[model samples]
Structure formats: C-alpha cells, structure tokens
Target: MLDFTFTEEQEMIRESVREFAQKKIAPIALEMEKTRQIPEDIIKGMADLGLIAPTVSPEYGGQGFDAVTAGIIAEELARADVTGSIPVFYLVQASWGHIFDKYGTEEAKREVLPNVTKGKWFLGIATTESDAGSDVAGTRTTIRKEGDHYVVNGEKMYISGVREAYTRGGGHITIAKQNPELGTRGMTLFYLPLQSKGIIPTYVDDLGREGISTGGFTIDNVVIPKHYIIGEENRGFYIVHEGYEYARGLISVICAGAGLQSLERGKKYLKERKAFGQPLAKFEALQFRLAEHYTKLSFLRLGAYWALWTYDQEAKGKATRFEVSKAIAMAKMFASEWSNAAIDEVMQWQGAFGYTRECPDQAAWRAIRSFAWAEGSKEIMRVIVSRELLGKEYISYK
Candidate 1:
C-alpha cells in the first residue's frame, strides 16, 4: 500500500517555507535576474533559517530535518524564483556538505560542516572540469601525495558559486586523480578551501542565475593538508555518485516547482484575459491544455516526493543503490522534459505578455530550460533509464 499524506508538522513546514519564499524571495527575483546577483541579505536570512542544510544533523548546526522536509523547501523556494531562490546553495550544502559529514574524517567534518551549516563557509562540488563534465571518471585534476600535504594541479570549469563559496562560504569538494595508473579509481575527493594560495578563480558571466558566479579556474601547484581528503584515498567515485543522485532528485523538485509556478502565472493571466466577450478560461482549447499540464505537474509532484521518500529509506541503509538511482532518475528525467513543455504551454497561453522581460514567466522559462542540461542532460537521464530497464550487459551505449 502507498500513502502520501503530509503529517501536521510537514504541512506546517510547507506553509512556512511558502510564506518565507513569497515574502523574501519573490520580490527580488526579477531584480536578481536583471542584475545577475542574489542579495547577500537574502542568503543570510536563508542561512539563519537553516534552509541551507535542513537535512544535515543538528550536531553540525543544521535543522536536521528529513528528506521530505528538504524537498518541501526546494519546491517552495523554486516557486518564488527558480533561478534565485538559493536552492542551489542548499543543494550544495546538502549533497556536498552532507556527504562529507557521512564520509569525511572526523577532523575534516569538525572543521568544515559546522561552518557550512552556519553559512560561514559555502560548500560546493568541483567535479566538473573543462574536459570532464558528465564523464566524471575522466577528471584531469591531479593530487600528488607529498610530505604532510597533497600538491594539486588542474582546472575545473562551470563550477557554481565560485567566489561566493570562497568569500561568503567555505569551499568545494574537489575530485582529483591521486593515482594516474588507476583510471577512475585513481580519483580522490578533497575538501579544498579556496583560500589555498595557488587556487585562482577567473569569473565568466552567465545568462541566468546572475547573482551566482559560474566560472573556471586552474589549481597551480596548490598544496592541501592531507586531512582534507574525503573517504579512502583513490575511492571517492561512489561518494560522487551518491552526491549526484541527491542532486538529481533535488533538481527534479526544482523543475516541477518551476512548472507549477508557471501554471499559476497562466491561471492569473487567464482570469485577467478575455476574448469574444468571455474570459480566456472559456476557450476550450487553452483550458484543455491547461488541464493536461496541471495533471502532468501533479504526477511530477508525487514522483518528486516518492523519490525523496525512497532516498530517506536509502539513507537509513534500508534501500539498494539500484532502487535509489532508478527512482531519482525517473523523477529527474520526466520533470526536466515535462517542465520545458509546461512552461512553453503557459507562454503560449499568455501570448505576447509571456515573452516580455518584465514578466516572471520569462525567468521561469529560462530557469527551467537549464534543467534539461544541468545536473544531467536529458540524454544522460534517458541513458540511466535504459540501463535500469535493460540489464546492464544488454544496455546500448552512445
């Protein structure tokens, strides 16, 4: 039997987050979109609310909520501004920072996670390099063992929250090759601080998510303390996979929220719009399309929650990797593709007004459009589904 009722507390959480997002995030969303910067005050308020690390244990200075709570927050924040709601900030802390709490050395966790939870040190993953976007196994960053330290060299690209992670937050969990002979096995993860002398950030302007800097940098002989290494040496691949799975699930919720918010915008427009002496709502064609989108979005909502529930079960070590991966990928892939269509439909329903820069619809459109590319591309999600549907040995490649 399947049940999908939110407990009283969960409902309160959802309502509270929705209120905060509507008040704090919605007002500045358009300005942030135009200026390309999320306000520091807003980020601070989010941090104070423990929105940055809701699922992390309180021992680490977090709210210690469960996966469902985190998902609720994701949905509400995304509703306010898909690009500027600071969910990506939360995603980084939850996925990267939480992974460290689980697998990092005691000294590493003690030093980092507290600051991360407090929003003093922004945490992020620097796994995507210039040559290694989706092919994480092909990471070119190298970390050579030295006396009491590891010397690092290589470049990472498209890294989110670059400067802010350093100035406003902690740093990144970097994946570097520790053994050139071991292929993917040679890769090791490090909680490298940006303050490391040889690390440099060269900022590149991005189209959306303006407040957050997306850029690349070269690690020129930077040396990190050996204590910063996460998990076993040359065995961080699984941790990266775990982080990616969590990120995928969150992105699914983000996409779904974008879709729902677009629908809300459409609904408001329909009530205000009239044709042939009747409201746009009277047009059977547009009404029918809106109904279909609403139905699809409802399914996406359930799918997002189910995936989070499955993940919670996994966190307790009750579920298998295959189960977790399959659920998260299913929600992620469907939501990404569906959101594109949902937003497009809303735009068509609004006609010329939807295309205007002043409207929130354009922001929602651009913001959700990236989900089809980020986290994992639509093609990558399909590959995941195919691998699960077919036996691994029989799955097609390319």
Candidate 2:
C-alpha cells in the first residue's frame, strides 16, 4: 500500500512555498506574457527560497531536497502561476540539475551548479531535434572527440529555455550521437553553453507559457571540454531517461495543481453568478461538473505524489528503475487530458468572460495543453506503461 501521508517538515515546506507563490508569483503571473520574461525579482526570490533547483546538493548552493519535496514545490508553483512559466522554470532546473549533480564531474559541478541554483544561470535538457521529439533514437546530432575536447554539430528544435540560457550565461545538457554504428548505445550527453561560438538560436511563438521562450538552437561545431560529459560516454541514452522521468513526475503534479486552481475559480463564479433564477451553483448540471472535476483533480494529485515517492524509493534501493518509470508513466498518462478537461469545463461555465485572455483559466488551459507532449507525449506515456506491464519482449519497437 502507498503511504500518502506527508511528513510535518514536508507540510511546512508546502505552506511556505504556497504563501510565497500566492503572494509573489500569482500577482505577476499574467504580466509575464507582456514582459516576454520572468521578472528579475521573482527569479531572485525563488533562488533565495532555494526553489530554483532545490534538489541539488547544499555544497553546490541547493537545499538537497528529495523528489517528494521537489514535487511539493512544483505543485505550489503551478497553482500560483496560471501562465505556468514559473513552474516550468523550477521543474527544468530541479530535474536536470539532479542529473548533472549526480553524473557531472567535480570540476563541472563546481563551475556550473552554483550559478544555476542561484538563478544566475539557466540549465535545461536538449535532446529533441527537428526529426526527433519522443523518438530519442531518431536524433541526428553528432558529437565527436577532437584532441583534448569534443565537438558537437546539429540542430535542436522545440526546446525550452533557449532565450534564458543564451542571455543568462548558462546552457543545456544536450545529447548527440558519439558512435552511429552502436545505435542508441552510441549516444552521448554533454553540456553545451548557448553563447559559444558557432551556436545559433531560433525562436517560435507558443500558444501559452509565454514568459519562458520555447525555441531551438543549432550547435555548429560547438566545442566542450572533457568534464562537460554527463555520466559515461555511450550511456547517455539510459541516463537521459532518468531526468525525463523526474520531469514527468513533476509534470503530473503540475497538471493536477493547475486544474484544481482553475476549478477554484469556477467554483467562485458558480456561487456568485446568477442563472435563470438563482445562482449557478444551485443547478444540478453545472454543480455535477464541478464535483466531477474536483474529484479527478484530487485523485490526480494523489497519483502524482505517489509517482514522486516511488522515484525517491529508487534512491533508497526499495524500488527498481522500471518501477519508477511505470509509476511515472501511469501518473502522467491521463494527467494533462483530465486537467485540460476540467479547465475547459471551468471556462465553459463562465460563459463569455472565460473565452478571453482576461480570464486566468484561459491561460491555465493553454499552458496545460503542452503537458500532453512536453516531457514525453501522452501516447508515449501509454506505451511506457504497457511496455512495463507486458514485459520488454512485447514492446512493439523492440
């Protein structure tokens, strides 16, 4: 049986983050779309609270939070930021930073992680290419050894944090083919600084999450030193999945939080707005939707936290990697669909006011639409769950 009870310390962390997010992030949440960036003060405040990449070690300027603690922070940030920008910023760092901390060399960790945790630099993952999104094996980027360093050459599209990393003096943990003949085993992962010579950035407009840039970068023979490699060469394929699992776990929680927040807005509208005779809350139809949405979101919140707990258990040797992967995939499979359904229904209840950008739920709905494919596609999540349940021998691609 799953232990759903949170520790007192965890509850305290939740309360602190909830207060900070409601006060600081909620007010400026929509303003980010117009500014085209997160305010510097907001970033600094999150850094001061150790929220940027709290999963990293204290020695590297992070709080060394566990997976569940990180999920709590993600949930609170999602609830506060209807635009969903701040939560993305926090989760990318928390997920990938954990990987870099665990696998990066001492020199690299000392040089990079401190700035990332302090919000002085942005760290993200970049494995997707024009040809590859969820299909990691289709990635065409190439990394080759040259003397004392390595050279990477390829184009990556639909990546997050492109603008931040380029302007903020940081970069992404990128993946490339080090040996083509070995297939997935040939893949290698390394940090590629965005401002390096020969690197070019491209931008695209997203339907939501406007505060953070969603674009791509072309790595044209970008040179990196030996220490930048994450884990061992040729093991990047296996290693990157760990980071993706961490992110998916957080995304499930974020979906639940955003949905519940939208429902709250809907609830307020139902109680205050008059229908044909009385308040909308008195109607069985609208009230039934409200109850159904609340129930699904509540269960989603529970499932998301359960996945995070399973992730933490892997660290303690109480669970296997496959267990963590299955738990995360199952949690995420219906997360975005269910959340978006709830948000869409919430919008429907508000009549014309909900259709415009003036409505916060509109932003929440747009922001959540991406979660179906962000870390991994919803279809891919179903595949992961089925792969584990039916055994690897039954995997279609295999």
Candidate 3:
C-alpha cells in the first residue's frame, strides 16, 4: 500500500510557508540581487516562523520538522523567491543544522544550534576545496590535535555563507585530513568559526544567488576546542555525505517549485498576450511545450518528495543509506536540467522581455542553473545512481 498523501501537519506547514513566502519573500526576492544581501527583515521573518534550521530539535529553538516538512518549506520558498536566495539560505541551514544536531557535542550544540535556529547565526557545510568538489578523499586541509585544541590549515573554495557566517557570527562544519596516510579514513569534521583570528576570507562573483555570498577562506592554523568536532575523528567522510544528501533533496524540490512557478507565469502570459491576432495559448506548438514541461515538472515534484520520504525512512531504519543515496541522486540529477529547460522555454514564450532582470523567469533560470553543481554535480548524481545499479565492484572512481 503506497500512500502519496502528506500528513495533516505537513499540509499545515506547506500552507503556512507558502503564505509567508508569498507575502514576505516574493516582494524582496528580486531586490536581493541588486542589494547583494538578504534583507534583515526577511531573515527575521524566517526566524519568526521557525523556517531557518527547522530540523534541529525544539530544545535548540527549532521546530524539529522531518525531511518532507523541510522540503515543503523549501518548495514554497523556491516558488516565491525568484532569485532563489532565500531557498539557498533556508536549505543550507536546515540541512547542516540537522547534521550538527545529530553528531555535534552537547556543549557545541548548546552553544551553536539555538543561535542558528533563531537566524542569529548561519550554519553551513564546508567540505569542498579548490582541488576537491565531490571527491572527499582529495581534501588537502589538515587538522591536528594540540592538547585541548585542534589546529587547522588549508583553504576551502566556493563555500556558501562564508560572508554571512563571518560577519554575522556562525561557522561552517568543516572537514580536514588528520592522518593523510590513511586517506578518507583519516579525515575529521568540526565546526570552524569564520571569526577565528587566523581565518582569512575571500569573495567570488557568482552567476546567480548573489544575495548569499559564495567564496573561499584560508584556514591558517586556526585553533578550535575539542568540543567543536562533529562526530568522531576520521569519520567526517561519512557524516558529510549525510548533509549533502539532505541538501540535494531540498534542491530537487526547489527546482520543481521554481520551474512550476515559471510555467504558471508563462501560462498567464500566453492567455493575455496576443500572438498572430490571437492569444499565444491557442498556438499548438507552444501549448505542446507547456504541457510537456508541466508534466515533467509535476513528476520532478513527486520524485523530490519521494526522495525526502526515503530519507525519513532511512532515519527509522526502514531503508538503507545506499537506497537513500540512489533515490536522492535520481531526484536531483535531472532537477536543474529539467527546471532550467522549462524556465528557458518560459523565457522563450515571453520573447525578449524574458532576458531582462525584471523578468522573474530569467532570475529563476540563473538560480536553478547553479544547482546542477551546487550540493552535488549532475555528473556525480549519475555516478551515484550507476554505482548503486552496477555495485561497488564496478565503481568508476575505484
């Protein structure tokens, strides 16, 4: 018996998030691109609604929502935020906060989770480096134990929330190799405050989602206490994947929501705008495209929710990690491509107006494009699925 219905609580969460996104996030979403910063009011609004890091336990100032519920909030934010800034902001915190809550020390959790869930601090994952994106084994950063502290060295590139965390007071859950001779087995995960004395931050101009900063930082022998370490030493390689999977699931939903919203705008335009002395809606070619895009996006939405549901099942020991990985990879692999194609067509439907900054779909197209490589590249998603289908013995990386 397969059930597709959302629970009563889930529906309420979706409706509430949708209302808030439409009323608050939508109006300022585009403005964020120009400002290059999310408005303080928007962050405050998300905090008030418990939309920031809602997955952490209520004891840590979070709503303790499940994965599906988090996906629902992400979908609404995506639909409303044309620039995709708010969705990025929400999903990163929600995903990494869950990881921190699950594996962080009680001392660290008590100090950090409450501030993050309250939106006073940003929580981010920082496993990617200039030399390594999907290959955790290639990490060059090192962390060595020094009495009561661990000193870190090396640089991380293309990390999200660097500026926010550095400026506003939070940090990334970072990974560093503690015993390079043991490869991935030697890695450790820990919280590294951006405000630490020896840390140096740098910025990058990204193609989209400009409101949230995307940049790198050099960790120059920054010392962190033992309490900041997440999970066990040499176990970061596994724990980091959990955060990535959570983020990938949210991204899948965000793509579906943004694409569907774009199609809705296109539908309205087709009905109102005259083309060849009739509405564009009457054109069979455009109508066919509209139908195809809508149908595909609908399935994408379903797949996204299904993936998130599988994640929940894994938490309850009803599904395996490999099952969750394959499902999530399948959900996210086509998410950016299909959504970008749909938005591109919507832009085509609008002719030249769609290319301008004022057009919402243009912003959406740019925003969704980044997801193809954000949490995990589409290429990596394909690899995960293939590895699952072909078994580890046939893994290409090996």
Candidate 4:
C-alpha cells in the first residue's frame, strides 16, 4: 500500500510558505544578487514566521518540523527565489540546526540554537577543506585537547556563510582529526565560532547565489570549550553524515521546485510567443521537450519527497540509516542534472534572451550547477547506491 499525499497540516504549511515566498521572497529575489546579501527584513520576517531553523525543537524557538515538512518549506522557497540564496540560507540552518538540537550539549545548545532560530546568528557546516570535499578521511584540520579546552588549527575552503557567521554572530559545526593514527575514527566534531580569536575570514566570488557568501576561514589555534563538542569524541564522521543527508534531501526537492517553476515560466512564454506560423506551444519538438521535462521533474519531486519520508521513518525506527543514506543518495543523484537540463531547455526555447543575466532561468541554471558537488557529488551518490547494493567488498576506494 502507498499514499502519495501531504497531510492536511503539511498542506496548510506548504500553502502558507508558498504565500510568504511569493509575496516577500519572490519580489526581492533577484535584488539579493545586486545587494550581495539577503535583506535584514526578510531574515527577520522568516524568524518571526518560524521559518529559520524550523527543524529545531520549540524549546529552542523553532517549530520542531520534521524532515518532510522542512523539504516543503525548501521547495516553496526554491520556487520563489530564482537566485537560490534564500533556499541555501534556510536549508543550511535547518539541516545543521537539526544536528545541533540532537547532539549539541545542553550548555552549547542553550547558547547557540536560540540565536540561530531567532535569525540573530548563522549555523553552518564546515567539513570541506582545500584537500578534502567529499573525502572526510582526508581532513587536515587538527583538534587537540588542551587542559579543559581544545585548540584547532586548519583552514577550510569553499564553505558557505563565512561572512554571515563571522559578521552576524554564529559559527559552524566543524570537523578535525584528534587522533590521526585511527584514520576516520580519529575525527571529532565541535563548534568553531568565526568570531573567535585567531580566525581569519576569506571570501570568494561565486558564479551564482551571490546573496549568500561562499568563503572559508583559517583556524589558527582557535580554542573551544568542552561544551562545544558535538556528540562524543571521535564519532564526528558519523554524526556529520546525518546533517549531510538532511541537506541532500532538501536539495533534491529544491531542484524539483526550481525546475518545475522554470517550466511554468516556459509554458507562459510558449503560449503567447510566436514561432513560425503559430505559438511555440504548437511546435512538436518543443512540446515533446516540455512534456518530457514536466514528467521527469514531477517524478523527481515525488522521489525527493519519498526520500525525505524515508528519513522521517528512520527517526520513528521504521527504517535503517543505510536505507536512508541510499534513498537520499538516489534522490539527489539525478536531481541537479535533470533540473539543470530542464532549465537549459527552457532557456533554449527563449533563444538569446535565455543566456543573459536578466533571465531568471540563467541564474537558476548557474545555481543548480553547484549542487552537482555541494552536499555530495553526483559521482559519490552513485558510489553510495553501489556500495549499498554490492556490499563493502565491492567498494573501489576502500
């Protein structure tokens, strides 16, 4: 038996978020690119609406929404914001905040989650380094306990929200090797505030999603208290995967929403725009593309939601972690490629105008391109699915 419908409560949430996104985020979505920042009003409004880190428990000022509900918010935001900035802003916080709420010590959660949910601080994940993006075992960052505290020394590159957390007042759940001899088991996870001493921030100009910063920080002996440690020592590699899985799930839905919305815009243009003797809609080639894209994107949307539902089921002890991982990987595997291909076809239908900066689909195309490697690379997704199906003995990189 299978049911493919959102709950009444979930439908209400989707409607509410769609309205907010259309009214507030849509109008100013492109403007965020010019400004190079999401407006303070929008951030505050999201906080007021409990849309910022809504996955955190209500005790910490969040709505305590599950993964599927979080994906709904993500989809609506993606539909509205062509720049993809607002969705990243929301998803990062929502995903990482879930991890923090679950594993952060009482002292640290009390000190950080409230400000994050209130939009007063940014919470981000910082696992990628210059030498390591998907290879968690290759992390060069080192964390060694010093008395009652720990000191970190490493530089993270290609990270998001470096400016926001550094300037606004928050930090990232960072990973480092505490015992190199133990391989991946040596890693530890802890909060490293960008505002801490000896931290130097650097910025990079990205191709899209300019509203949110993509940069890195140099951790030169940044000291953190024991309370900042997330979960147990030497188990960060496992805990951080939970956050990555959450983000990959959100990204899948976001790709579907953005691509579907682009199709809607294409539909309008096809109906009114002239091509040859009639409207572009009458062209068999374009019609086939539109139909195929619509159908594929619709299935992508369903697969993404089903992946998220699997994530929620895992929480209820109905599914396993490996199942969730494989499901999320499969959902994210084709998400960006299919979405980008659809957006590209839509842009092609618009001719030269599609390649220009004014074309929202161009921005979307650029933004979605990053997801091929963001949470996890598409190649890595295949590796995960293959690993699950073929077992550990068949793993190539092992």
Q: Model 3: per-residue lDDT, tens digit, 1-398?
A: 98899989889998998999999889888998999999998899899989999999999999888899999999999999989988999999999999999999999999999999888999988999999998888999999999999999999999999999999999999999999999989999999999998999999999899899999999998999999999999999999999999999999999999999999999999999997799999999999999999999999999999999999999999999999999999999999999999999999999999889999899999999999999999999999999999999998878
Candidate 1's C-alpha runs over 4 A off are none
lDDT scores of the candidates, listed in order? 0.81, 0.95, 0.95, 0.95
Higher-ranked by lDDT: 1 or 4: 4
Deviation of model 3 at 97, angstroms? 0.2
Q: In model 4, where do residues sit more than 4 Å from their true spots?
A: none
lDDT of model 3 at residue 180?
95
lDDT of 1 by residue, 1-398 (tens): 77789889989988988888899888888887666667877778887877877766787777777677788888888888756337676666776766777788888888888888777788888898877887788788899999998999999998887887767647888998988799878889888888778888888776666656777778999988888998989887778888888877888888888888889888888888988898998888888988999899889988988988898898799988888888988888878778878888888877787788876777777777767766667777777777888869966753
Angstrom error of the Cα, residue 125, model 4: value is 0.5
Give me candidate 4's TM-score against the actual structure: 0.99
Clashes of 2: 0
lDDT of 2 by residue, 271-344 (tens): 99997889999999998999999999999999999999999999999999999999999999999999999999
**Global Cα lDDT for candidate 3:** 0.95
Candidate 1 local distance difference test against the native:
0.81
